[model samples]
Target: MSLSQQQELRAILEKGLPHAAQPYLLIAQALNTTEAQVLAQIQLWQEDSLIKRFGLVVKHRKLGFKANAMVVWNIADEQVDDVAAQLSSCSEVSLCYRRPRRLPDWPYNLFCMIHGTDREIVTAQIDAMVKKFSLSYVEKDILFSFKAYKQQGARYTKQGI
Candidate 1:
């Protein structure tokens, strides 16, 4: 895409796509371009690794998921990947990732987020996960979320290009 087109795309993305039936078509009209052209450019950008992810950002609380917790586990280094995959497959797990452990203080590495309408439900899901994974002996922690701030897409500027 040309520099001007890139700038326009970035601007549109910063404001986020419209919540309409034909968001891309609306965006195309607003940008004075065809919907197919806009979609082609977006696909090209994805192929070029410019866009890491493209999906809806749901408001969990608004969807009646009031209780959420980040469950961190200190699994063996060799088992982290397998455990992450297992947790990622669970229906209760909203997100799963692996992070380095802060040794001697924080030893947790694998992390998963669980969400539910009630705290007890979240806890029960966590318990089920532990039992299913035979993680009774695994060191873990649950940090519940108390608040959620506003969510927004990344802001890109022409100067940053």
Candidate 2:
């Protein structure tokens, strides 16, 4: 989808997903199109990679995950796949990704975030992950959020704020 289309869909999502009275119908009303057309367009957007995912944005802290930390790992270059597989399998991990390591200043390459009710629990989980993977070189750090200014999806459209 072009920037304009993405922006339009995002604008609608910002308002909220359609209600049960008429899900697609409501979206269609907002977009000034038929419900079927909206559904087909959304499906196409998804299939074509214009939309990565569409779902509820749950608040982790509200659900008791009060402690969240970014776990950066310096896995053996050869074992990145193995490590990422293990990390992704863990339910506590909410996000994981692989990126190039900036050595000397930043040695960790693979990043995974774990959420828990408290810092201690999160630390314990990280320890378990380390021991389970037998990753001796992996360095773990707990990054607590001191403040949250903007925690929401990206605004696809650039409307005057």
Candidate 3:
């Protein structure tokens, strides 16, 4: 409701989600506001792009997803959008995005990360995606990850973002 309260909300969000069944409800109660208000504020922040990224960073290995591959694709400039959209829609795909290709070296522009329980599972998922979507990639590489680094959400300081 007030500037101080909004900063408090941001602080809570930056520390990562509350480990509760109804995390939002807890936050709203603490702010002496309704759950809807809290959600609305978050929505407004997202719409305004106040936060660059607001999503859970799942520890795939801890969840038994041992296999993960970053599928690098050199998709056609014209068809990349459609292909990326389709890839993003797949449940198997955890992340999909486009990056500028570095010519004379790295040529892949489109990227998607697929996770599974095993190497075979991840490989099959990639193969299935290529077949199911008929992704006519000029070049494709399945870069299986050998290691995973720590993942954390954005940090909201007392000064606020």
Highest-scoring model, TM-score: 1
Between candidates 2 and 3, the lDDT winner: 3
Clashing pairs in 2: none
Residues 3-55, candidate 1: write the lDDT tens digits: 68767877887667888999989988877888898899989889999987777
Better of 2 and 3 by TM-score: 2
Which wins on TM-score, candidate 1 or candidate 2? 1
By how many angstroms RMSD does model 1 differ from the true structure?
3.1
Error of 2 at 23 (Å): 3.8
Let me know the TM-score candidate 1 reaches against the reference structure.
0.80
Candidate 2 per-residue lDDT, tens place, 127-160, comes to 8888887865666566776555666756645551
lDDT of 3 at 138: 56
**Per-candidate alpha-carbon RMSD to the true structure:** 3.1, 3.1, 3.9
Instruction: Put down candidate 3 lDDT per residue, 76-108, tens digits, no spaces.
Output: 888889989999999998889999999989989
